[model samples]
Target: MTASVILAPLVPVVVLWVLAGLAVAFVALALWRGLAGWWLRGLTACALLAALANPSLQEEERAPLSDIVLLVVDESSSQRLGDRAAQTAEAVAAIEAKVAGMENTELRVVRFGDGPEDAGSLAMTALAEALSEEPRARVAGAILISDGQVHDMGLVPALPAPLHLLMTGREADWDRRLVVKNAPAFAILGEEVTLTLRIEDQGAAPGAEEADLTITVDGGAPQTYRVPVGQDLDLPVVLPHGGMNVLQFATPAVEGELTERNNAAVVQMNGVRDRLRVLLVSGEPHAGERVWRNLLKSDASVDLVHFTILRPPEKQDGIPVTELSLIAFPTRELFVEKIEEFDLIIFDRYRMRGILPMSYLENVANYVSNGGTVLVAAGPEFGAVDSLWRSPLAEVLPVEPTARVIERAFVPELTDLGRRHPVTEGLEALAPEGGWGRWFRQVEVSPRAGQVVMQGADGRPLLVLDRVGEGRVAVLASDHAWLWGRGFEGGGPQLELLRRLAHWMLKEPELEEEALTATARGQALTITRRTVAEGPPGDVTVTGPDGAEVVLPMPEAGPGKFETVWQAPVVGLYRLEQGDLVRVVAVGPSAPREFEATIATGEVMAEAVAATNGGVLRVEEGAPDIRLVREGRPAAGRGWIGITPRGAYVTEDVSVAPVLPAWAWLLLAAALAVAAWLLEGRRGGRRVSGTA
Candidate 1:
């Protein structure tokens, strides 16, 4: 209960003061005139003046409100480390019990977990918001139960009372983590790029002086290298053939209080070709010579080296050999020595020639078998007696041309299998008006162990693609692709088709027969499997960094592509496998930052708590009993926690009664004057008689 006074004046004080002054003046005048019984007149005047002024007393009632205590609990990822989780559970129970026993007090418990973006702990932010929703007068104090790792300290509210912290975790905790300082999103294929990385130690590291850093590419054998702690190193790595190159860099596990899941980092670099080296060998200079040169030279990234055999070995000019304009073709230098240097070998309208000996042809076949690409652009000469089928290169070529030439205008059409293949799919642009430019000539071909992608008129094979050992080969039976480029009978996407065929034969990973691919956007990963078979979709098994397996149901996305989406729970390397395909990718941070010392030190919140006259009390030491303490007194007892009461009040107005009315005061004064006169007259008469 509480009490206070309020006032409303029924009579003005200024008017009463004037009336009293007049009464005093009249009494003084009587005394100056030596009037009989002057003391009696003054007494009568003073009694009249006292009746005008008004005064009163007011009383109020109040009941004390309950004090509010804010309880902030931390539930971030860091709190799950070691015995910290257990410690947090025990402390929460003690706090609940202690707050329950206090009188005229209420508790507001708030729990904060990891932020949505995994920014950091959100304990302070949640507490601030909770505080704003409560009454300030009732908040006696605030208590935080966390590991002292707060990411949103700027959101700490202006507390009305003291704030206390009960930190989690113990001393002597340590961790070691891998750190990637620099990485690029893309790298040129077959080029060495340098990546900067380092290993960092925090809290307490192992006793070993140095640690071994191992690096692996595409899950190959890891190469171990010794690296010093806390120092960055530039690692020169050569990217493999094509597509997304997954590189895993890790350091050996160190004995520590932290988990090893953060001890490794995964980086992906998209491989790109800066320039394609293509070798074009021609048996003789013909009308179709410009077609091959123009197509290869049109692309900025294609490095073309063309050699034409203008003069035959049997031809003997009458003039001296020096007089002839033709120079001897460097068959040995191009075909035998540096054949592997070129990515693709194009034989445009080339027949078996004596210029390239049988030995050189054998070397070309060996090159194709060892992961080199070859494209044979056949002409009428493909049906001649000197066809390449009689040479050593016949084993890798996809088609064997019969000694027959079909001369007729025919439109090219995609085969049944080619309709779904990536190389030939979505090729309506090649025949926008329902048909491509007609070819006047095409050689009859019989495909061996290869796929016939295109057929000419009369259902004869015109284009064939095949896998030759570790490499790829393509054969275009018609030499009239140039006629399309010349815009004969309505031109089509002749260049686009040719470009896709060349790129596919070079073994672009996206065009592979069987592939497993995973793409990450935010925290969700999309896994895809592409194959050339018809069956039930396979199951994609994903292994997270913590060795937890999640089987995702793959559904057919298209004719040959199967896809599934998986939401990643944590940020680290994720391994995916379906059938023979395997892929690994990193999510979130490349490596965990070593910002938290992990030792659970009070240094972060000790100063702030002390400013409010609060002391640190570990719940493990036992719950301190709650006690009500008087204001301006010490807030702690031997085995109790003290809370100070805050007294608050609101004001109200009350009416006051006047002491007396003007008419009443006037009547009393008249009566008093008459009595004083009578008394004086009697006294005077009595005195006169005595004197006589």
Candidate 2:
């Protein structure tokens, strides 16, 4: 309870003050002049003022509030490393008991874990929010139980009392991580590129001055190298093939290490070729000759070597052979020597004219068997006796002529296999609306051994493709395919069909008839299977980073592409296989942000503790005692921490009453005035018996 004096003036405060001053001056003047009636007049004025002034005494009742203490717990990814998780659980239970035993104190526990969107520990941000919800004056102290690897320090709240830390983890903890300082997204094939990499040791130092590093490309055997630790090294690499190249770098796990995940890294870089060479052979010039020439010449990456046989060996003119002849390029150099230098060879409207010996044709067949690609565009002469199929090349051709020709307008149809073959799939020639333009001429043929993807008039095999030895072969049954280029009956996808066909023969991975590919988009792995199988291509076998395998079925996506997306469960390299085709891909980063620094330390929260006159103690030394201390004093000691008493309270009830009554003041003033008047009259020797 407490007492206070308050005044309720009858008039305004300013007016009351002026009247009091005037009364004081009047009394002083009368005393100096020695006047008796003046004293009586002063008494009457005082009585009037006393009655106007209203004063009261107030009493209040208050209730005391307990002090609040915050206990922040760090449960983020970094805290789970090593023994920190166990350390945190033990410290949390001990602190809860210690805070509960304290007098006149309230304990608040806030647990924070891994942040959303890969943001690291946000200890300061959580502390600020808890502080805002509680009264500042009632907050006695703030204590944090963490590894001290906080990521948001800018949000640290101002302490009303003291702040302390109960740190987790031991002094002997350490970690090693692999870092790619710089790497290119693209590297040209057959050219060396430089990549900068570093190996670092954090927390406790390792005894070895050098570390063993291993690297692999495209899932091949790893190559080992000895490199000094804590230093950047430049690595020169030459891409082995033209496509996606996966470069994986790893360091062997050390004894007493925090985790091995950070010791490995994965990088993906695209490999591209510099140039491509092609060889084109024509038996004679015809209406469709320019179509093949125009297509090859338009591509800046291709170098075309065109050879046209204008005269047949059987042709015997009356003029001498020397008179009609000009410069000639020897066939021996092209067929027998440097034949592998060409990526693709196209024979258009060609036949056996006896211009070259039988040995040349046999060389061509051997070339096809030795990892070379050949395409044959046949004409009406393919069914004749002098056809190239009758030579040694017969063993390599996908089909044989039936000595018959069909010359009627017929629209080419896509076989079930063509709809699933990458080269012919999704071509305008397979559209639902009447398909492509009609061809007027096609030769009837019996398929020897290959995939017959297209049919001509009377359902005859129009296109056959096959693999002979290590090379590929494709035969088109009609010369009228070029009529589509001229928009003859409304043309077709002449350019698109031929381009994909050429690329397919060149062994483009995207156009392979039988292929398996896995693409990573965040946590989802999209697996696609391309095949010309009679029915469904079946399930795909997936191998994870830890060598675990799972068979997943594929759903049809388009004509030839079957796809399915699987949610990845972990971060590492994933290998996919469908039948004989295999592909390797990575789903997530080998080293995530959480594993970069796994060792526990209190340096991140040291500034906040010191600013609030607090101290940090290791939980390994046992739970600290809870103490009550004054603000601005040291709040921590060897094995104990302190909280300050806020002494906060709220008033419950109040009472106000006047000390003096109005009538008593009036009676006293009247008596004083009457006595002063009688004394003054007697002294002046005047009769005092009359009442006026």
Candidate 3:
């Protein structure tokens, strides 16, 4: 219970003040005039003023509230390293016991893990939010239990009491992190691009001069190199394939390192072609000749070189070679000399005309065998005596001509393998309601090797893809594909089909017949396996960042595609493998921000602790004793941490009453005035008698 004086004036406060001042002036004037009853007059004035100024007593009933202590525990990924988890558990248990024993105090524990999207340990943010939820006046202090590698220090709240840190980890804690300073999102294929990287050693490191670094591209065999540590490494790399390429660089973990999570890094770069050089050789003027030209010319990245054989060596026309408008075909230059410079060579209805020597044709076949690409668009001439299939180029062709041409119109369709193959996987879905447009002509051919993806009249091979040595070869059995481009019977996906075929032959990673790919949305991994083989593509083996393997069955999602989503238990790089196909995908960040700096230190929370007159204590040295201290005093000592008592309470009941009633106050004022008048009158009578 508490009591205090409160005024309830009978008149307005201004009016009361004026009456008190007049009474005091009259008393002073009587004293100056040597009145016989000056003391009595002063007493009367005091009584009257006290009566008008009514005073009341106020009493309050309060309930004592316990002081609140905030305990913010960091359980981020970095905390999982070097026995920090055990240390944190021990410190929290000790602190809880101390706070329980302290008089009039309570502890509120807040445990937080890694932030979303690799934002790292948001210890300060968690502390600020917890502070906002409780009353500031009741707060005694805040204590943080972490490795001190806080990533959100800027969010530290304005604490009303002292802030202390019970840090985890040892003084000799060390870590090695791989930092990618510079990496391009897009890089030209076959050209060297420089990537800047650095391997930093933090904390009490052994000061090794160099380390062994292993680099892997597209999950292939790794190449190890000895490189110096603590310096920027400019690694020049040439992309091996077109499309997305995943590069992994890692340094083997050392014995005494805090963790190996930051020892590796992954970079994804889209491999692009500077220019697709294509050589188009046309046997004669044909309706589909311009189809290939138009398609290649439409792309801004393609460099097309087209030529037509207007007069063959067999034609006995009396036209002079110089007088003819046709330029001589550079057979030797295209097929032998600079053949490797071209990315793709297309022979549109080309026939053997004794123009290209047998050696030149052999050179073209050798070109295909040595990592080159060739596409053949066949017509009736493919079945003739001078068909290109009869020349040395036949060695690389995937089909054999049967000297037959089907003149009947037929609708092209995807075969079972074609439906599964990347080149023609979804072409069937693009067909119009009435089916694809019909083709009036198709050369009869039997596939000797390679996968037959498309079929036409009489179930004959319409499209075939094969690999010759290190190169790729594709055969399109009809020249009427242009009909689809011309919107014949509402046109099919002519541009799409040809584009897929061309890119597939050019060795695009995404269009590979047998491939495994993985994408990450947060920690959920979406694994997709693509294959042209019959039946279901088998399950995938996923290896997590911790080297734990889990075999997940990939159910068939579509024709030739198998996919499944797996929730990852943690954030880091993950490796996926199916048969010989292997892929690496980073779930959140290759090196999570938490592990980027693992050394436990007080620098991050130094300012907050100092401002609150608190100290940073290490769990390694044992948890400190808890004590109560006054505000604006040192709240931390050598072996103990103190909390400032807020002396906060809730008022449950209040009572207010006037010291005297208004009628009693009025009667008392009148009585004091009458006494003063009587004393003055008696004194005046005595003076008169003395004078007489």
* Root-mean-square deviation per candidate: 9.5, 8.3, 5.1
lDDT per residue (tens digit) for residues 311-392 in model 2: 7777767767677764464688887786888889898988888776799889889989998899998898888998988999
Task: Output the worst ten-in-a-row residue range by lDDT, candidate 2.
Answer: 681-690
Clashes in model 3: which pairs?
A: none
Off by over 4 Å in 3: 3-58, 216-222, 243-246, 268-270, 308-332, 352-358, 537-550, 567-578, 583-590, 658-692
Q: Model 2 Cα displacement at 2 (Å)?
A: 11
Error in Å for residue 399 of model 3:
2.1
Candidate number with greatest lDDT: 3
Q: What TM-scores do the predictions have?
A: 0.71, 0.71, 0.84
Candidate 1 lDDT over residue span 347-434, tens digit each: 9888875777888888888998999999998988998988887889897887887888999988888877666566776676557574
lDDT of each: 0.77, 0.84, 0.89
Report the C-alpha lDDT of model 3 over 338-403, residue by residue, as the tens digit: 999999999999988887888998888999999999999999999999999888899999999899
- Give the better candidate number (2 or 3) by TM-score: 3
Error of 1 at 482 (Å): 5.1
Poorest stretch of ten by lDDT in candidate 1: 1-10
